[model samples]
Target: MTYAEILSHIYALGRFGIKPGLERISRLMAALGDPQKNLPAVHVVGTNGKGSTASFLSSILTTAGYRTGLFTSPHLISFTERIRIDGREISEDSVVHLAQRVMAAAPPDTTFFEMITALAVLYFAEEGVDIAVFEAGMGGSRDATNILDGLLTVITPVALDHVEYLGADVPEIAAEKASICKPGTPLVSARQVSSAGEAIAAKAAGIGATLYRCGSDFDACWKAGKLEYRGVGVTLHEVVPGLHGRYQSCNAATALAAAEVLSGIGFPLERAALVGGVENASWPGRMEMFDGEPRILLDGAHNPAGAEALADALAEIPRGKLVMVIGVMADKDREPLLSALLPLADLVVTVSPALERALPAAELAESCRRQGAAVEIGGSVAGGVERARELAGADGLVVICGSLFTVGEARGHLLSRPFEAFRG
Candidate 1:
């Protein structure tokens, strides 16, 4: 199949729509010879920061001279962004070939995520990667990526998102995510709410996995104007993270701890690699910036916790009036999301991505109005961003956010890039 045709097939699989089980994926992987078995990997799971942590860990492993594969989701612009080796996205031709191979072995009940996850593992094994880093699509235990036997599991701050599918609150969500902690595996976790921490601790203890808490076992912070990281027996100063936002410091610290664990477990990772990796790691659509008049910041902060982080980051940057282009999905907690950013925005240009799941522009605008925000309906993601830039002017700032789909559309618009046909 050609690239477009294969992408269509992959997207068509979405009709299965998030079946919450491992049986289908297991059957598909078994049909494809179980390529995920024994692959040295680091599995990253959380409500937020999963991509950033996986990016940092992948870069660190790559910097240490290991051929690394990274599998992430919700591509910002192109489908190729979902799979990468050594920081390079999989080529279009490779994607087409791999999609074909994966589809052939896929079960009739296979979901889009399962097929994609299978393709990633198959590609990594075929390419002979020394290690791979996978970001869980959702809860860890039944996530498609959970098929891999990762040497370490990293849980970045769990929060209340995916409630219907995962659970109702922090403890329930944390337990679902923490289920990725395999027996005897080293599980590194970021600082969490007490409930979340306790849930994760219980899971680790129950499974006999050694738990490493961020504050108790290691930490990262700006001390006397320098970034410092204290890991499990390894201390590094001047640990600069390539990503923006204060929340990223915690994510980086978690990755650093995981790296330290990998090093101890015969990965041969060194200080130089650890420093270089965090310094160079990059995750797009999360506090990503584009230069020009009225510089634009792109962040996919669909949840309240993520919105709060974006708001905090915006507070630190010096700018004139803040014009925000916001688009969120229909199922998200819109009130809490808007509450975090509405007060900070001088103007909110509401838009909807070209997606079936997106909340309509009028609905989003109504929500913004209810919050007493200065809101206007911009119809589409591109229109909203363009309108926001005009409102922001050269001296002001424009932030595009609310969902990855929104960021992806704005990014594609600003860069004049074509998007892939598939999105899930």
Candidate 2:
């Protein structure tokens, strides 16, 4: 099929909606000859920070001279962003070719995510990657990416997200994410709330998997002027991880811990490579800022936990005022998200991201209004960002957030105008 035809076919499958089971994915993999078998991978599971941790692991593996494949979800701009080999996104031609092949072989009722997961595995296997890192699409237990028996499982902090599919409470949600652990595999987790930690530990114990908690086992910190990583009796000093945001320091540490664990299991990872990898890992749309008089910051803070992190990060930057351009998905709980973000905004402009699931701009504005936030309705991302920029002029700041869909569109809007001061 052509690229447009391929994309239309894939997106059309969204009508099937999120099917939370592994039966179809397993069947699809079998039909494709099980490309996932014998593939060394690191499965990243959590409510937040999954993409960042996966990016760190991919960077570390690649820096150590290994070919690595990275697969993430919900592409911001292009479908090509989901599959990457050694930091390079899958080419459009490759995507077109793979989509046609997989669709022909897929079983009836296969989902968009499952088909994409199969596509990634096929590409990684064909390319002969040394390892692949996968971000669990949602709850880890039955998520399509969980079909792999990754050598190491990295669980970032667990939070309440995708409640309809995952679980309603933090511990229950944690249990779902913890299900990614295979028998006797090494699992590394970031600092989770006590209940989440307990649930994860319980799940790991039930499965005979070795659990390593952040504060108790391995951790990284940016303290006293350097990045200090302590993991598996290996200490790395004065390191600087490539990603922005203070939370990323912890993510780098998680990646380091996984690297050290891999080394114990016979991966020839050198010290220099670990140091270089941390310093070079880059994940866009976390706290990405363009240099300008009034800098534009794009963060994919769609949920409460992510929005809280964004608020903390925004608090640190020295700006005259903060004008936020926001959008959200209809499924996300807006109360806590708005509570966490409104307190930091001098002005809020609500927009509808270019997506089928985006919450209505007027509804978002009403939510902000209820919360006592000074709000305006921009209706669209481009218009919202323009309005925010106008409010934040030169000396202030325009922060675009609420969802990756919003930030993605804002990035395009800002990046396209060559005359905009924020343009690179």
Candidate 3:
């Protein structure tokens, strides 16, 4: 099949929606000769920071002379962005070939995520990668990527985001994420709330997995303008993180610890590889900024916890009046998400991304109004960007956020790039 035909075939499976169990994926992998079991894997699961940590680790491994494959979700522009080796996106021809292979072997009622996960694992295995980092799509226990028995698991800060599918509270949500831990596998995690920490600790202990919490086991922080990372049996000073924002320091630390674990298990990484990897890692659509007369920052902060982090990061940067261009999914918890960001905005330009699940611009503006924010409907994502730039003027800052779909559209518009039509 051609690229367009193949993409349509895969996107059509999205109608099956999110079936969170691993049965279908497991069956599909088995039929494909179990490619997932053939490759060494590292699983990164959390509400946020999964992609960044995975990108950091992948970069580190690649720099250390290892063929590393990185699999992430919800590509900002192209479908090929979901799979990469050595920071290069999978080629369109590769996607077409892989999609055909996966479709031929897939079981009945395969969801989009399931098929995509299978395709990634197969591609990595066939390409003969030394290690592949798999970022979980959603909750851990039954997430499609959870089928792999990873060398180690890294959990970024667990928070309440997917309440309906995962759970309603932090503890319940943490438990679902903690289930990614395999027996005897090392688990490295970022500092969590008391409730989330307890749940993750309980799960790790029950499974006999060694747990390493960031703040307690080892930590990373900026002291005197240099990144310092302290991990199990290793310490690095003067580390430089490639990504922006204060929160990335924690993510770089988590990736460092995971890399240390791999080295301990005979991966042969040197101190230079660890430092260089963190310094070169890059993930788009998270704290991404485009500089111009009116600077535009694009972040995929759809939940309250993420919004709070973005707000804190914004507080440290020196910028003029803040104009927020926002859009979110229909099922998200809107009130708390908006509450964290609304106060930071001098004006809010609401928009609706071109997707089935997006909340209408008018509805989002109403919610912003209820919060007593200065809100206006910008109709579409592109319109929102234009209106926000006009309102922000030359010295002001324009922040586009609330959903990855929104950020993706704004990014495409700003960069003048064409993204795939089916972004479901």
TM-score of model 2 relative to the true fold? 0.93
**Candidate order by decreasing TM-score:** 1, 3, 2
TM-score of each: 0.96, 0.93, 0.94
lDDT values for all models: 0.89, 0.85, 0.89
Backbone clashes under 3 angstroms, per model:
0, 0, 0
lDDT of 1 by residue, 248-329 (tens): 8898999999999999887989899999999999999999989889999999898888899999889888999899999988
Give one digit per residue, the lDDT tens place, for model 2 in 259-355. Answer: 8888887687999989998888877778888878688989989777788788877767889988999998898788998999999999999999876
Candidate number of the best TM-score? 1
Of the candidates numbered 2 and 3, which has the greater lDDT value?
3
Better of 1 and 2 by TM-score: 1
Per-residue lDDT of candidate 3, residues 66-136 (tens digit): 99999998899789888999999999999988889899999889999999999999999999999999998
Steric clash pairs (candidate 3): none
